[model samples]
Target: MVQVSESLFYKDVLLVFFEKEGYVYSNSSPTLLENIAKNLNNLSAPASAPKNFIVVHKKIIATSAFAVGGLVLTPIIVVGLIQAIGFGVGGIAAGSFAAWLMSLNGGATAAGSLVAILQSIGAAGLTAGATIGTGAAGATFMGTAGAKLFEEKSDSIMADLTERMDSNPKGQAQLDEFVKVYEEGNEDKNSEKGSTRVVFEIRDKLLTNNEAFKNFLETFVLAYNASKKLVNKKQQFKFFVDKTDKMDIAGKKLENLNVHLVKNYGAECVDKQAQSCTIMLNCSNL
Candidate 1:
């Protein structure tokens, strides 16, 4: 579990919205997310980089580990950068972003197109070429947009909370209580306690009585769901890798063979039952 800053939390909500609208693939592999986050965070865009792009880039990776519920980094880095850059220039929705991506491949989003390649990277994992290419593209897009996009007031949950805190003493108190409980749940070392559970508790205990709180709860659930999906994906990948390590194959040491097996067969094995996965790998000619 990781704690997100106020700004980063807002960004995560925006990313969750983008993901739900099918604008970007936010549920990418943890390894891929971490690497892309690291590279983009360290990237020093040229002087020509647009102010808005720099702002989005800085806001996305403000955290040291670049992890906000494990779902924010990848989408913001890979595809959101393009959309955010567009936002700076004008406003673009999911459809517009898809059209722009299609234009990159001469108006085709079929296989081998940039759009398809990005989807493939999201489904599988990043290759060395994808890493360099995405980073370069992010940098290139950064210079094409200005910073006025985010200057307008946001309608995010955090903005709602802030407005409530400024205008309503009772609601502010309730929000403070919600924050305290949420932080305590996040800091709790118990395996059973997580942000999703914390959010449910907050909804049940604090928000059930208030209409404003209920509205907030609905928005907050999106972030919780995104976090849950990321956690599940990471666990599944780890499980697949662990199981791959235990297989006994002739003429090949498990340590040397495990990486290749997982890299080649991970997508196939990830969703299957352990016994079935073992059978498939064991029967493979590789």
Candidate 2:
């Protein structure tokens, strides 16, 4: 009775784990923020309460990988074991049955030949089932990991886009224009990160109404990349455009590609009166 109770307890514990793991995958699917939330929740679970948050964080990372890996591998191992056991047992049973029949029919050699064929088929099936099942599991894990990683990369790009737009109204306007033109979602792709995207319609409007607005476009791209580089380096910075597309003020074809820099982009930081050019001399100038 005690042994049975202990077994039941472990089984219930596994079921709970399976439930939690399943929820993690379901809630986190197709979303990075949900994945983070699930991680945090898991970290704060009763099992994790005994450990420091940092340790919990590390465990969360490992658990994410292992949990997904187990999901991939468990079925495969089970199937392999089933196939091996079924075939091994069935082959022996068939061989014995064949010999018994042969003894009654006085055809022992013929029955032995039949037994050999059955054994060979059973061995082949077992080998094939195990190999295929293992391969499928590995592939499943690779696919899931690949999808999650791609989502992370895309989130990073969206984040940079949001930071760019928020830092510059004109840039944000241009982005809005692009979104409308491209028929893409205007909401910040990084929904969890409080990021926003520029609309394409707004960008087109600027192009049509403000022909010289091309400088804003060029400066926007340059500043965005610069800011991204800084962010990658783990630097805290803000971005602002000092100068805009004002050459000939109404010139076509962007004659002077110039940009000005604000020391550190913030509401409190005053814009410098002097302008520093980021890109003033296009090769067209010689």
Candidate 3:
């Protein structure tokens, strides 16, 4: 079991409360809680890697192929099976034609006509075979294309998300709100004796919009990473993100964050010495 001291635990709670309130420092007086919230939001940002076009292109191609195959193969199989079992009608027609011709002539010409009728039967068989082959080919093409398209689409979606991450005012505000909620929830849960149970409940609430929020965060991170090389090399980079339902509201969350851009890697300056950057984030509300 891990043992924690009462004073240490309260101290941690105080820090959390202060961070959540967006504390700031001024020349005369500092509202510690207000500064904490602002600082936390300023520091806590999601990943911003650039969208990879190669991946997006690949996904589109794959999806197109799958669509082609599904359109071509499924109907072919259903119709083909029906034809295979129903070909008896064609066989009967050919037999009737032979019998009718025999009644009209009993000489060598009748024999020649019979041979021609047999050739027609062979042709029908060849056509059926070709139909089945075509269906198989279509299905194969769709499967290959669909796989590629999936990969490509993932890349494209990520790229779009990152572009939006850089410029979403709504998203930043949501992050601020999330920090406030998280601090309140955490403090409430951790206030009592044997608080683990309460904390677990709070965690569940935090994960409500987590999946969508995670997707949003990834886009932001990807975009931020891509843009870092273009801006002043020494200018510090920061991100603010909210991991909650606010991101799922779609058109209300943010915009201009998910666009694509290019940068020259060789001309960029990276901070190798900057290691202690802290990210103060609010617990997710799912």
Candidate 4:
């Protein structure tokens, strides 16, 4: 009767731990429980099982790889965003704009040149101080000129467009038409008609033929895309870390239970060379 009571107590302890860890045990599909038992058994043997046991936790393996990849890629993406916005005013869209800028100045990103300053911002960041400000001021001048055609809310619209462009490429024409109407609707500070409408009356066109405006839009798009991608990657990394932490806690709980069993039931309950304890306390049905 005492032996049976002890067996039931151990089962109850295992079940409680598993339940606390949000694991549901079922005899119909005992794979999860079997895996836990195998891992617990391996934990009892420190010499032969430790290395093999680490490999068995696939989450650890995936998390390690993901962490390394994020570490490597995050800086690159951040730099890309800074370059696109801080220096050029476009994120991913800045690629073409950068090429265009280079082309305009005989394709030379030589020292002290506009392209050189922009490149510096990409490599380091806005923290490059006065040098970065020079590039940003030049980009801002271009952006300000573009801003004249549309209302103050154009910046917000551009941001919305970036997200839309990133999410759906097919909606580009619709987005362009929306921007055209939005710009045309703006009340011109200097004239009765809006800047866009005035331009349309003179040139029979609403879209600015200005290269600066084109480059500004490109830079903004590129920066937004890079920033969005970085955010998503960070969220993914956080999720993996959370899962790893939960697994670590569960493993510790199992180890504590093993210690408890050994203290009350003797060394025979958790044989270091055999997994008799794991089999006895499988808690599969629970």
Task: Give RMSD to native, each candidate.
Answer: 20.9, 24.3, 27.2, 30.4
Q: What 10-residue stretch in candidate 1 is worst by lDDT? A: 233-242
List the lowest-lDDT window of 10 residues for candidate 2.
277-286
Score residue 236 of candidate 3 by CA lDDT.
Answer: 23
TM-score of each: 0.23, 0.20, 0.19, 0.17
Clashes of 2: 14
Index of the highest-lDDT prediction? 1
- Tens digit per residue, CA lDDT, model 4, 1-286: 0111221222222332232232322222244334333323322333342244345544433442233323222333334433543344342233344454443333445575545655565555545533423333434533443233222222322333233334433333332321211112324253334222201011111122233223323322232233232221110000001122344433433354445435544555332212221212111111
Q: Predictions ranked by TM-score, top down?
A: 1, 2, 3, 4
Give me the runs in candidate 3 sitting further than 4 Å from their true place.
1-137, 173-286
Residue 41 in candidate 3, Cα distance off native in Å: 27
lDDT of 2 by residue, 130-247 (tens): 5444545644643454344323333433343333333445432333342222212224242324322221122233334443244334334333333232222211211222234542
Q: What's model 4's overall lDDT?
A: 0.32
Candidate 1 residue 17 Cα shift, in angstroms, is: 16
TM-score of candidate 2 against the unseen true structure: 0.20
Clashes of 4: 10
Clashing pairs in 1: 52-147
Which pairs in model 4 have colliding backbones?
89-219, 89-220, 90-219, 90-220, 91-219, 91-222, 91-223, 92-222, 92-223, 93-222
